[model samples]
Target: MAKITYIQTDGTSTIVDVKDGDSVMRGAKLNGVPGIVAECGGGASCGTCHVYVDKDNTRPLSTMHAVEDELLYCTASPRLDNSRLSCQIPVSDDVDGLVVHVPEKQI
Candidate 1:
């Protein structure tokens, strides 16, 4: 299991143990982390599961696919260099200490 931290807009932090191969969105949804809406259920179709990857993380995430890249443009929060769809980020040992900040809105 990989330990992932989700920081809410209000500065609340939730740490969850996400199973390997599960998307980061899956970990939030399963643990009731109050940020990801996941309207498309990790299909990478909706941008509700958007997150900002902490710049301090040392590991590099997988390359974004075309669909996920396009969808990032539609997220409620302004997109940033670190913006990413949680559904597209799979949890693994490489990202054991991953920290993501949840935006204020997901609509």
Candidate 2:
């Protein structure tokens, strides 16, 4: 299981254990992390499950899919090099201890 952390705009934080094959968005929403809206339910349609991955961890994740790239570019928040739509991030045993920091908002 991957250990993911979400930091809300209010400064509160939630930590969840994600099983392999589970998307980060699913893990967060299932665990009740506050800031991830996940409006499109992992379809890459809505940009609501946006998140800024911790810079250090960005290198290991798979390359961004085309749809993910577009959604990230159109998010309400400014895109960072580490920015990603959480729904597109699949958890894995390799990412077991992975940690993600949520941004201030998702709109």
- Superposed Cα deviation of residue 4, candidate 2 (Å): 1.3
Candidate 1, residues 1-107: lDDT per residue as tens digits?
Answer: 99999998888999999999999999999999997999989899889999999988788688899999998898898899999999999989999999999988889
Per-candidate TM-score against the hidden true structure:
0.97, 0.89
For model 1, the run of ten residues with the poorest summed lDDT = 54-63
Off by over 4 Å in 2: none
For model 2, name the residue pairs that clash. Answer: none
The true-versus-predicted C-alpha distance at residue 11 of model 2, in Å, is 3.8
Residue-level lDDT of model 2, residues 1-107, one tens digit each, is 78887777666778789988999999999998887899989998998899988766743676698999988888887888888898988988766666677777789
TM-score quality measure for candidate 1: 0.97
Best by TM-score: 1
After superposing candidate 1 on the true structure, give the runs of residues whose Cα lies further than 4 Å from its correct spot.
none
